[model samples]
Target: MMRSLGKQTVRTHYQHIVAGVHDPEHDHTHETRQTVYERPDGTFQINYMSGKRFVMATNDGSFECVHVVQTVRSASGSTIMSVIAGAQSLAVNRLNAVIEFESGDRWIEIEDDETARLAAGLTQTAVGHFYHEEERLEGRHLRRWFVLVGPSEDLAVVGKVALFVLPPHETSVDPEVVDCHIAGYRNGNPYPEFAAEIEALAAATDLPITPNYMGDPVVTPPATGRTPGL
Candidate 1:
């Protein structure tokens, strides 16, 4: 009865028992955080903590060229949220940026000087990109302000702003904007010092001055996390 271990198979499993194969759970780590919540129907909801990365697609309804970290299902053996390092867009990253922001609270004062400087540069760059469009009478100044805030700066400000590009579906934080604002307050920035520029430039045009107000609240980041010494 020991004739053979042969044949109807997806591949030659015995022959192709090699490293770096197509095993989805191969690199899965034990560090992945999982939390279970009991529903009224006695069904359990599980939250799987995974890092952010770009995803081309998934069998689930979530389909995007970017990695998506969502609390959708409670399946313990569900697919891991894998993300590509150095992914292009932070807005679409599959990371728990809010958690990172909360973790970063311990270092806020130390980081923002540099973070703010970078944000200021992006702010200046955005101003240039919208110059021609501003002449076309398009307003969304806050949206324009958000263009290059990156994960640290702008994306954290997503839900707290009057004009937010992304929806408020997940728990997140924008360290860049808040940090930069803090840096500006501690140091100096033409953003607030010369905020009147936006108002002046917008008076004869349709640009909004609300983005000018973005500075004040930024110094005091939202109650998104544990803001140390504040």
Candidate 2:
């Protein structure tokens, strides 16, 4: 069975670790202490990035999925959302969704069990703002998608990645957060690449291709197809 979050109030814990290796992304291996939080909710979200970078790991409970994020930040100051919807490249099975929403509600809806599993099974876990907290309305206006993953899952493969989609004119920069790491980002979708995995998931789901909700339109998903899950 999968673990999930309940209605109880919770607090995050902090930890520090040191290792000897080279990080291609940052060109460094040493890491600063970071905070980690596990929402008992079925999403299996694992906040494991170092305090220097804003990243996340997630579990896709409802669909047998997993995801990660190398959260990007915006150079400009604005309320934005980086939504995921398609695959990155044809060589891998990861989905890529790095879309920016500056002024409207967004959603990453799963239409069926197959799609849910596909969405959950990808690599990482993250959220977007097509359904973020905006204006005076509550968070309900912004629809978000959650997936299931476990603590023991290995991310050595091309697990799905959640990239932040930055504005066309802005440069993506690493965040300078201190103390507690952040789960939210404004740059853009962390993964903007595409893959066959997305095409398979779309075939097994029921959300409309060109969808609209809360006076805003969602990004078009990959073309649909039949896969093992369906």
After superposition, which runs of candidate 2 have C-alpha atoms over 4 Å from their true positions?
A: 1-17, 20-137, 141-194, 209-230
Give candidate 2's error at residue 190 in angstroms: 9.9
Q: All models: lDDT?
A: 0.25, 0.26
Per-residue CA lDDT of candidate 2, range 1-230, in tens?
A: 43333221112222212133322442211111223334445233323221222224425222111122243334553212221222311212333232212211112333233434343334322222211211113322222242221112222122232211222333323242111111111111221222233333233343222222111233553444432221
Q: What's model 2's overall lDDT?
A: 0.26
Candidate 1 least-lDDT 10 residues = 8-17
The residue pairs in collision within model 1 are: 52-94, 52-95, 53-83, 55-66, 55-67, 152-176, 153-176, 153-177, 156-173, 156-174
What would the per-residue lDDT of candidate 1 be over residues 1-230, giving only the tens digit for each residue? Answer: 12221211111011111132443332211111112233455433332112222222225422223121232222553322212112223422422222122223211111122332233232322222222222233332223222212233522321111111222232224322221121122122334433333223234234333332324443322233322121
Q: After superposition, how far is residue 156 of candidate 2 from its true place, in Å?
A: 5.2
TM for every model, in the order presented, reads 0.18, 0.24
Alpha carbon deviation, residue 15, candidate 2 (Å):
16
The candidate maximizing lDDT is 2
